[model samples]
Target: MAKRGSRRATATRQQRNGKQEPPLAGWRLWLKRTLVWGTGLAVLALLFLGVAVVFAERSLPSYATLQATQPGQTIVVRARDGSELIELGPSYGQWLDPDQIPQPMKDAMVSVEDRRFYSHFGVDPIGLARAVYVWMTGDRRLGATSTITQQLARNLFLNSNRSLDRKLREGVLAMALELKFSKQEILALYLNKVYFGGGAYGIESASRKFFSHPATHLSVSESAIIAGLVKAPSRYSPTADVDAAVRRANVVLSLMREQGRISASEAAVDPSAVKLKKDTNQNSVRYFTDWALPQLEVLLPDTTEPIEVWTTLDPGMQNAASNAIKANVPKGAQGALVSLDRDGAILAMVGGTDYVTSNYNRATEAMRQPGSAWKLFVYLAALEAGYTPDDRVKDVPVTIDGWSPRNSGGSFAGEMDVRSAFAYSKNTVAAQLGNEVGFGTVASMAKRFGITTPISTYPSMVLGSSEVRVIEMTRAFAEISAGGFTVEPYGIVKVTTTGGQVLYQHEDTRKAQLVPDYVAAGMTDLLQTTVATGTGRAAQIGRPVAGKTGTTSSNKDGWFLGFSSGITTGVWMGRDDAKPVSGLHGGSAPARAFSAYMKVAVKDRPVEQFKTDLKLPEWQMEPDEEHMYGDPGDYYYIDEQGNLVEPNKPDQAGQMPFPPDSEQGSAPGNGQQPQQQPTPAPPSNGRPGDNPQAASDDFLNRATGRGGGTTQRTEPRQSGPRSVTIQPTPQN
Candidate 1:
């Protein structure tokens, strides 16, 4: 024991003198080596991360553009009063301050999206572990576990491509963003940059678009609704599918309640009661904006700069028109309505039922046969050719070029005056007059009034066989409203940059007279007979009205074009595929739609008479005594199909196929009786106007919160005695 102790002491003494080391010293040396290696590896990892960050920072989109508060970041469209109408940009909404963000909104987002948003350092380790487990098992439907800061980083500087490289780069960038921006700043950016659907790119826009209120005023339910859209905006859009949207919002509310962010009572509000205000900037607004967006370049010369456009759209008128169509038109059948001032400023335009479902602006894009509506140009040609409204015209059936034109009611009124013929929508008179004036003259008259579509010189051109856009037809009618002055339709009133520098200002483009004032006066007098005592009686609004009613062969297209002194509107309804509506006719849906819209549009505006020099043709006013139908009620009845079925007995095979409603009667104008058939039962829906089966299934589903079924609402008041219904022919 003494030798061992002496040896150990000597070894210690020798170690102190730099000779032999103790046995345990080897373990100490091994630990030191391990520490050094680990430190070097850590240093290398950090160095590599820094280099990668530098490279990624260089590859990012321009930082100034990303952080810009104007132009590239948010392009705001405004109403004339400087109210924001819409926003167009990848990142929209006001850049809210951290202090300005409501706590409830933040809490709801955090609870539903990332509970550790405030706690995590750019990335959550636990979340990463769980994500790995999910990914390894290929259960990708579990969604992502990215932190809010990380999402901001991805939204700002990262491509959404999924790859290990992208993920690493994202992680690096997320850490960098964390270092650069404080947590509040990061949260603010995230909130401002997130997409909330319905073309809204930020919380503010989403709130305004959905609730018609600003983000600062959003209620707890509203905030949850907006928050729930972060995952799939289009799928969860309130406008697209209200039930789905509410269901998602309920999920968010439940999460908030579960996380103790809200009280149970606060979450107990009925989801159905969370009524979203109807969006005025929907399809109708989009139609005008889309037409005006391309004009921005011509107006601005440099579209790169942010600009504000003042359009001619009257929000009140637009809303009225949109509501009118929505309230009156049945589902499945597409309808378009346009309201214009005499000078051709578009007051309102509704292109279709839902712009999201179908962007094809029927008012501007579709070109369909104008049916009897085309008779305006034909009558104008006849007037120019020295035909007076009182002149007697043969109403016997006539066929031109293998095409036989028939009126809505299949009977002929023989030897009726021109005014009475037009009032009754007599097909035989219209066809005969077209032949007399020459199709070329009629085509020329239509062109002079702004009908730019190809006008064939074919005889059927008199019957609106060739297609013309609704907008085009509207413009043509405006010329007559302008007292023969050519009116150029325009929507944009002004364009200016955000800095208030004017880029474009509207100038009246009304041109010199395109039609003789006398001709216009005569035509107005003739058309007024339509609204006063003819097929267009449904469109009367207790004022002087002049317009035409139109229905095509097989009832495929229906139209009503009428004008007061202040506004002229054209309404068209039909299937997109040209399928015939079961019992549809011009005098039904289109006429009532016209009446419904005008009744609101003309409110508060002074009622004025159409300016026309009533140069007495003296003879034009004489009622035809010979062939006059006994009573208006005897002339028509609402058929099961909603069409006005005339009881005209068929003539011999060679006689004119069937003449439309005859003004006088069947034989020579001496008060002769016409053959007739028993009237059919009216539509079972009790209303002559409503298409019960035409309501949208999707709309009904959302309204009732049941999938795959429809509910019927009571028929609205009708302006006429007959209703138009449509039945579609199957596609090949």
Candidate 2:
């Protein structure tokens, strides 16, 4: 039987190879082998895919954790009344429920991001197939296959990385999210967690940022525009690129119409003509927030938790101060104004002309010469050394170590009381006073008052040659306003965590007495004369104010540092390069700016009188009546000519002919001509011999000395006389 079977097989095989068999027999065998190999390869691909899915699932976050994903919130800054000042860190606006989102906005997002959002189980099989086909075909569009839930999974769990591994991981996470949450929940999380441009973190913040309204108020066109920004927030941002945003919005609208979310007619909504709400908190409050940020770091160091900061900033005063600077500061010139309470609460601070143009906080960072404003410390040193405001000081030409410190106008009224000297901002008198109290004493006073800049013992130190920051000067002045108590200017009042836990609270703990009550009173009275009869007259706000005007040599910087009972303010104006501003003086722009700010700052506040009880000694009688200018009464009413007119005394018309107003511009202490004298001369006690003409010529020549006039030195025949002229003194 085996032999018979073998014979039959051979015969069949022969028949297959012969003409009697079908011609395609060999092709059938090849087709069977190809089928077997293809099936084996398909099973291997399935096994590899299953292994990749398992690995991706292991890499994903837990289901419970994914469902509970919440991004870190923004730090909220609030004004005193709980009104939002600004937000620090990435701001996430209010989160809305799934149904709270507008229908059009949701539809637009669905049409552009994922048309099969509702039908997909986190992963869209049909979309995935289409993507694969397109990718295999090398299509240029490179459309994404991720459903909205898949996008949410990537945004919430995965970082922005374009890799095959991340794609696989994202798919696994999307599946996990779909199992743990509903479609609406996924969409809500996606809308709330996606990052938008310009520091906006979510849909609501993006809506407010682009349209200046809540997400619920977004129109269909606006929704389309917003939806288009999801792919590339910076490139399609309406605020950043209007035309790009319009193109993107049109694309989104077309897609919406194609998806039947909107009709063709409705898709015609004009993106170019769309009304956008103006962005709020753009620059007005940025200055304050910028300043407050450092304080937050100091108050709460190395913190990642969202915090609420209650600041001492007065929004009303901030707006007013900012407006005053914008309105009053001259064009092309920048300005800084700072206001504070007696206890060092920063009320309002305008750091520069515009925070957008420059973030340099001139008010806090600029350390320019305080000019005569620095005299406060010098006089404070004098006061500490038992020098009274009425103590006599010579306002004469002074040459200390080859450096001749001339008065502003170069003309010096003979001897005057310390009060008048400071009020007038006499450079010579201040130099002499600083010398009498010892340079160390003056420097120590400055350090105690928060002046951190290096101070030289040079005679010019008394003339405010030492540079100082505006905030430093303001804080020092606050010490005087607070009855000689130390004041550390602070903005943040309290900080709390988002969970209602108090992190830090500011306390008025600076209780150490920096200046004695008596010294503070004397200083306040002396500075008051500066505003009352001195260079800071322009800063007078029809209230009991005390201040000083300071103009650096050549007008490089101008400052009006003043304080009332309730508030202390400092104003500074100068070019960034420290180049002299033409005709700029402390009393002109700074004093006027201080006045303008205070006018609105102290509105409706009851004016309180400054307490002046530190009794100053009586004025001394004139030593040389002929050479020395008369007392305050004698020169108080000088006319255009050098004639001194007795006030309300018609009979006493010509007691003594004074120098012309040109010789002695304004009062000694007013802002218009700070430290500006008509001439530089010898000491008050020593006069040039009996030649009155020589003295008069010397005064006029010295007054106009800056203008090509030459001066000659002449030694008095007498040896070691008390006073000496600009004429070279005897070398010894």
Candidate 3:
């Protein structure tokens, strides 16, 4: 039973051991596989948790510390007494209190830029996913997931480089900004920081540029148009292409409707109804701007600061001046006008007929001969030289150093008083007076009057041969209008920061006594006479006015410079090439234009006379005896008997009073008259009665005769009574 039981036991044991061992091996293999799989699952779970942590960290708000540095942008505008006229800016940025921005504009911006802007915390997950999906699908859409806060961050803290890294940075900055600032604050920043083209950076500038109004006044459609430009400003720029801009605006309207930001009915309205104000390029006042530029800089030394320039210019006046020249200027002619206050404050200046055609600034840049208008200086010099208006000067042909000047009509009056000569523009009289007063003296006076150019003391210079610019002449004449106080014309009155910080203020520091008040007054009187009755008659404005007309030689240039109490204006008309203008004269064209302009300019203003207190010296004419005659060919006579004689008639005995003495020593009528008889040949010693001696004494007595005296003559009186007595005349 041991052997048999052992064998059975061995088999059973072996079976059992084999079974157990297989189970153990199987258990080991299963354990090893389970352990390996479990470890892998744990590792994978940890990895996923780490990735989720990273993504969640990215999704959370990143509080980036931004350095809010405002870039330098200047807003230049011309204003006067609380009214704005011309305005220009670089990077059209305008910072406004949130309250100042129209609610419609804000709503439009949110609707177009980011519909979920108000709800998002810097990152819009839905919008981001959509953008990613679109990008992955190769559509390459730029509808970023960035909210307004994020855009503000990108504009404020990040570079504009469009790279993945930059985008991430933008996103991080945006989140940081959102976490640090409220939604309203972010919107305000974004609205002010975004670029709107044409050097405009903010909505305010863009609004003003496009609508010619403030951002606070933007209409719903106007707001929509501006919001639409943020995507691609140049593409939607009203100036670049209005049609394209309108189309883009319509798309914005559609987006607004799709987002429920606007009603479907509203979106259904005609796209044409979304009227965008025309963009004016802000160059209409280029000439005016250029003119005001230097003054602005001078007024505000720090141009980096925003400032307002209070000017004297009225937009209406400027437009009138511009249009007048444009309408009247010939096709080939170029012209300019400068209107200013008597105090030298510039009101309006048109440098050229059109700034687009040329910015040459003919009003201030062009230098040309002023023609007879310069004769005023000659008259002024004469006034200073103790010459009176009534003093007569010969207007006959005159030559100086071989130079003979002719009048405008190539004729001359024999003699004319100063007023008539000046009125008629007699060239000879002007040249003569200029010569007498000394050309250097006149030039010196012109210098005091604000002429900067060198004036040569040549005879022709009296007739305006020296070239001078319109500005110089205008300013010079303004001194006369200002009652002899030299004035420096300036366009800028004051400059200030956009925030109302005063930067600079112009001082009337350029004052000097250019001429005596009385002298200036006299000249003004003469100029007034000119406008009233002389060549400048066309410039008469039915009011107290003073002016001068200028027509350069060859009819190549014409000018009318005049002033009323409140303002002085100068107008010039001529060909750009300096060629002759047919039938053109200052009195005909420019004077008429001047009168027309002044009539409008001074209509509402009070009459202002030059402030002066000096008394004028009285002027009187000098006598000329040589010219007092009837005829050079006529004759008159006195009889030998001391009786008056008539012309072309002979005298009888009684008409001749007494008879001639005979050679015999007695009167012819009575042979021996007691008194006439040779009283007695006194002393024959070669004295009174001696032959040659007596004759010499008689001649001496006759030559030195007193009331009643006698003399002996041998020569027969030609064509009248004969004298028989002969007398020898003394040598000495």
Ranking by lDDT: 2, 1, 3
Top TM-score model: 2
Candidate rank order under TM-score: 2, 1, 3
Q: How accurate is candidate 2 locally (lDDT)?
A: 0.72
Candidate 2 wrongly placed segments (more than 4 Å)? 1-72, 89-280, 301-306, 497-500, 615-732
lDDT of 3 by residue, 60-130 (tens): 44322221345435556664455776565565445776787888678788888888888887778889898
Where does candidate 1 stray beyond 4 Å? 1-73, 80-83, 92-283, 614-732
Relative to the unseen true structure, what is the C-alpha lDDT of residue 315 in candidate 2, on a scale of 0 to 100?
85
**Candidate that beats the other on TM-score, 1 or 3, i.e. the better one:** 1
Instruction: Point out the higher-scoring one by TM-score: 1 or 2.
Output: 2
RMSD of each: 23.2, 22.2, 34.7
**lDDT of each residue in 1-732, candidate 1, tens digit only:** 999999999988998899784465687888988899999999999899888766755655453455564323345666645666677765366766778888888988888888887787688888888887888898856558678877877776655666778678678887777666678777777777787865577788788788877788878988888899999875677776677778898899888998889999877446676777775455567766766665664655534566677777888777788787777665668889988987778888888877655556789889989999999998886675445566556666666657677766688766666789899888777776665555665776787777889988777777898899999898888788887777788888888788998888889862656655666887887888988998899888888889999989888999999898679999999999999987677778888888888988888789887665644221222234322223332232322212222344344753422324434323444444446633322112211222122123443343324553433222211111111122211111
